[model samples]
Target: MSLNFHTMHDKNPDIVASLARLHEHHFGARPTVITGLQGDGSDRQIFRLSSDANEPVIGIYGPNRRENEAFISFSRALHQHAIPVPIIYTYDADAHIYLESDLGDVTLLEWSNQHDDSSSVLTMYRQVISWLPKVQLTSKDSIDYTKCHPFAAFRREAMQFDLDYFQSSFLSRFLRIRLDNAALANDFNLLIAHLLRAPFDAFMYRDFQSKNIMICNEQPFFIDYQSGRKGALQYDVASLLFDANVNLSHSFREAMLEFYIRETMRYIPIQEKKFLTFYYDFALLRMLQALAAFSFLVFQKGKSYFMKSIPNALQNIAFLLTQDDCMLRRLPELRRLFEEDVLNNPQALS
Candidate 1:
């Protein structure tokens, strides 16, 4: 006798099918195809769903539901404040799929890269920087920090996270060098303590760089701001100026800093000297965090794209190391390790 067995159907929901459904609901029909866009550090998968009926919309499929929630909530809050973030259209809370306005393919970095004119590039940068103070200071009282991803503020814990992350991902994994951990810890504590005292009340765009700012319709629009939270005002500016991938010139960076200070004064009272002092300290911290992320991507995760950024990140660190008045000079062992194991080693170019 011949016997046949019946197969059981799977219960798990199809995310692509859900996304298609969402497209249909929004666009009157499902898109012909969903093309994926290149992503940054996050694990979120982004798709551009397009059809003839309407403009294309961006579909975001993120693994972490809470992270997606944070972004959606934050985007709503920012939009409510009249900030230039992409307008989020719909969200399927259960499926962790969300749709938002497609801000086009060009980032500020891409736009700047196409131009050979320094004046035009600097103007573009100034335009973008002008929007920052609005994000930081405008509608200042309404934001709910609890909606911020991972944490509410860049407090001591946050600083320590960057320092420890650098130690693990760069110092230990990439360089394969041993250092005086106790001494480094003391230095870390000092740096954190110093940074913690900077103006921590502003909305810091934790990773504010050219790549995160999109250029659409000849205007600057911000993106990738899910990591934003309460932190020192100087950190975001530092991140943009010291961005390893962008490799902004020292003189250009200083010019932008001065412009930022002048713009900042219009919104709030600021002592230029004090802000500059804190700015250098924050710049050092941002460089360390960036190096950690680059090393983590290149060495630990085997992503070669980040390898190109290593030299510039190290150069920024070297520049900071030379600053006689910077807090980084106090950390002798940390300085020595970066100099000997990282700067001196030709293998770092790999």
Candidate 2:
């Protein structure tokens, strides 16, 4: 789990040197050392490279070639839209090195956890949503999805997030569950199919959540946004509001969702009824996605940090399933599994 940038630099000394030189050229001081190693879900190693005279620290990322290009392209697109993401100073596509602005250490999650009152936190979160439409519409026209790895190309990789990993590896193997119901298995497969086919035409911050968002100088700044893509807008909203990691209350989640809908209307031409429907559908899809992810964390990764969230995750899933009879009927076994196994036997689910 420990990220070693020194080792990464050793593998690509030339690229590292080029980054250091770029940092010096941009900031008028050579970087002191690379720091910070707690980033998740990325093969890239993020580092805060220091400079003299209170210079803005530079972020260096070591990733594969395609992601490097996407990061560069996406960063430029966001910048053009006046979105508060980091500014890229330099990039070496071949070496997969990215030199960019450092937004500092105080993430939205850290700020919310530190304060007693979340009123200010909520305000900043709303501001982030205010900026979302600009990011979505502007970025939609700027970046080319064909330039990066396509979602269709990731079909096999996406399946890793489905029952194959969750049930076979995590549940059956790690949780030691001897699942008796074949119907439950069928429903789970159906749910996965439905999600994989969900419309993905908008520019999406694939990992939009509190942790990747920073509150610097009282303004919300986006970080770890390189995984952004052309995906459902509701997917990003669900990622933020229903975030299991930060654990915001239901009241606050509702308030934020309302804010998003109202604000999104100002930019997009969608009707209120259609938008509301999409919101509920996306919420259900996201909750089911989280359930699968939580299952993986507990059963495969052995991360107990997600155990407490399972009940709430199942509750959200249940709430969403109730919205659509087709979804409910199609995934009836999943509904039963949630009620009988998850809702009733919280201890077992945990």
Q: Over the stretch 1-350, how does candidate 1's per-residue lDDT look in tens digits? A: 11111120221226656777887887687677566677777677777777767888888888888778777877887898888998999999888899999999999889999989999999999999988888887745666788777888999888898899999988888877787899889889888888777778898878899889999998999888888788888999999999887878889999999998889889999998888778888999998999889888876667788888888888888888888757888877777777777888886755
Q: Global lDDT of each model?
A: 0.82, 0.66
Model 2: colliding residue pairs: none
List TM-score per model, in order: 0.93, 0.79
Listed per model in order, the count of residue pairs whose N, CA or C atoms clash below 3 Å is: 0, 0
Question: Worst lDDT window (10 residues) for model 2?
Answer: 1-10
Candidate 1 wrong stretches, greater than 4 Å: 1-13
